[model samples]
Target: LDQIILNLVSNARDAIEDNGRIDIKVSTGSSEDILEHNSIVKPNADKYCLLTVSDNGSGIDEEKLDKIFEPFFTTKSAGTGTGLGLATIYGIVKQNNGYIFCESKKGRGTTFYIYFPESDEKPSEKQLIGKETKPDEQVSSTDKKILLCEDDEGVRNVLSKMLGAAGFNIIEAADGEEGLRKFKENKDDIFCVVSDYVIPFKNGIELYEDITSMSPDMGFILVSGYSHDVDNIAELNENRNFSFLKKPLKPELLKRTIMDIAKHGND
Candidate 1:
């Protein structure tokens, strides 16, 4: 819910150029109302919670509304946006068994409607337990290390926390060059390398090549916000030791990938 609200509000702010109004309203409605709004039948629920975010800004083009939820589809200038915000919102909505619809007019304005099944049950807090470690992942060595290379500090910290929670020792670096150097220093103990495609000094692919030259079977995962970035890395397909993940990564997916690599020896 926090992610959905933050992304929607952020996108609304970006759309406005001047003194524009952004409105957010939350209300309760029935399933019949939802079906009328999107014409899509959702799971039967007695009541639903509706969230509406509307903005009077440079609205999206009618044709582009359909593609707004797609990954890497952004109206912002290059380098200004990753185009993952809306896509992330869409995924989150769907994951919660919710529905989302967007209405926009080029010059008039834009509005987003999100619906989630209302639950009367009180929210329960549950501890998050890490997945069971596969037998193959339990190497004789005490250290289960992952070399994490990401330029963004926030993203780096988040990934670090996630890996750390999964019982992996994290060696962090801000860029490709630092990552490579760290990998070399810890080469004997490092189990996997997780890196972003674009970074200072050297790119992810170059880093992959340099490290693989010495350890051909080194487990590596490359992450990128742009799909084309992965497509351009021909070495990825040829190397069984390497895998690529598109940005806006989910924690479960990341952990699963690492476990798979560990269990299979990156083969």
Candidate 2:
């Protein structure tokens, strides 16, 4: 939700040439009310929440509305945006058993509606923990094999070489389907699966499920350009001890995540 809000705000800021209006409305309701009003299923039956962010700026063209959520589909200039923000948000919302809808008109405005399942449990407050600054120089000798799944050829090659140079044998897969095949074939030899969240055929989460079902101890790291709802990722991380690395990834962050998982074995 934080990421989604940030992306919307940033996009709105970019769209506005001088001054514009951004309206943020948050509401809580029951499944029945949501269904009655919105004509959409409440993400969860017991309770539900709705968050809407609307921006009065340069709106999207009608033609691009359907493609906005497609991965790598962006209207922004190269290097300005990854085009992954909306897609990532869609994936995150879907993963969390939620639904997202966007309404926009060229020159009019844009609005995004996000519906989340609710619970009686209180929301947990989180404390900010600064990143570890002290580096652990202890080199790992674990000859663990990793399944590297990435759609981008350049990213895949770079990560494969880096992991290989780190004394870890890597099985490279171009997309999610191939990754799943390789993982199933080398289930015993594979120690972990590092995958891009957006891939051809299937996605990282789908692959994670397939691999983990076969090898209960199998580890996963999801690399993506952006995210919509980090809470969904947090829930997964807490439950499965999986890790996520945001894109435009730094080599250091990747190495740290790998080393942490390799050393502690997901706690």
Candidate 3:
């Protein structure tokens, strides 16, 4: 929710000229209201927390509205926007069983209405991330060390926390080269190599190939943020020693997967 709100606020800010105002309001609503307000043609569930962001800025046009949710669609000048902001936000909201609606006119202003379903049940791993550990994942095993290779420091820190909480011992590196070096230095100790698909010095496949040459049955997991990079959720490897996870890595899947390595062995 924080992420979605921030992106919307940022968009609102970008839309504004001079000192235009942006308003954010959160209120409870029923599904009937969602339909009546045209916030959603038909919301799937009953209760909702409606988020409305309004900007008194240069409003979007009717022609552009249809394409706003499309990936890489932007009205801002080149270098001012990446065009992935709304697309990513749309993905996140819909994935969590929510709805998004927009109201705009060329000269007036633009407002976005987001309807997030309210649930008493705890969020699933696919919903809100970083829920409590699974029953089986509660057991800690420090011996199952992981070579975590990610270029971004912020992502690495967050992932390190999740890995530690999930009970795996960590060996970190900034990029594929450093990751390979760490893997070599601790070859015997490192049971699994979890690497970012795109990184400096060497790519993930190259790193995997290099390590696998030395340790053919090395447990490997290729991690990537882009959805297109991983086509074979089919299986990370035919031998069951390889796997993959998309980023903004969810806690439960990460724990379950790393633990799978321990239970199944390096193979």
Model 1 bad stretches (over 4 Å):
1-44, 49-80, 91-97, 100-114, 118-142, 231-235
> Please, what is the TM-score per model?
0.63, 0.49, 0.61
Root-mean-square deviation per candidate: 6.7, 13.1, 7.0
Model 1 lDDT at residue 208: 89
lDDT of 2 by residue, 1-267 (tens): 656775676677666656788899999856665565468453356566888889888899889888999988998878667887788789888998877778888887888888788766764454245343454545453568889998766557767877788788989999889999988788877767898888889888888778878877777898876665243786777745488888756666787677777766624
lDDT for each residue of candidate 1 in 88-163, tens digit (9 for 90 to 100): 9998899888888898998778999998899878654542454566675664323678999998775688789877
Computed on alpha carbons, the lDDT of every model, listed in order, comes to: 0.82, 0.77, 0.80
Model 2: weakest 10-residue lDDT segment is 123-132
Q: Report lDDT (Cα) of residue 124, candidate 2.
A: 46
Mark the 10 consecutive residues where model 3 has the least summed lDDT: 230-239
Q: Which residues of candidate 2, in runs, are more than 4 Å off?
A: 1-139, 229-231
Runs off by more than 4 Å, candidate 3: 1-46, 50-68, 74-92, 95-97, 101-114, 119-139, 225-236
Q: Give the higher-lDDT candidate: 1 or 2.
A: 1
